[model samples]
Target: MNQQHPSMEVMCHVHNCKFNENDYCFAPKLEVNPLQGSGASNSKEALCTTFQPR
Candidate 1:
């Protein structure tokens, strides 16, 4: 069986990010990882691994 996921808005503030268009993320896929290998304790400690420099 195939599953379909609902689309949602992804807001971005990094003007230099390649996938950022009009303050929104347009990447085909989004990847978020912990800033450190250990783990993220808060939102600030997490990082967008899918970020690409424009």
Candidate 2:
């Protein structure tokens, strides 16, 4: 039997990010967390930017 959802790809441009490598985002899933400073408050957010449902 096959799964209902298919795998997808996500890309990110956040440099210095732990998950960033060679301008490619290898994050298997989207997970957001609270970000402090940098002007935007409550910036914690998680999302699957590269999700493709089939």
Model 2 segments beyond 4 Å from truth?
1-6, 32-54
Question: For each candidate, what is the lDDT?
Answer: 0.93, 0.53
lDDT of 2 at 19: 65
lDDT of the structure predicted as candidate 1? 0.93
- Name every residue pair that clashes in candidate 2: 32-45, 32-46
Model 1: per-residue Cα lDDT over 19-48, one tens digit each: 999999999999899987879889999999
Best by TM-score: 1
Error of 1 at 19 (Å): 0.5
TM-score of each model, paired residue for residue: 0.83, 0.38
Candidate 2 lDDT, tens digit per residue, 1-54? 886865666566676666677766666666544344333444343333343332
Off by over 4 Å in 1: none
Model 2 per-residue lDDT at 18: 64
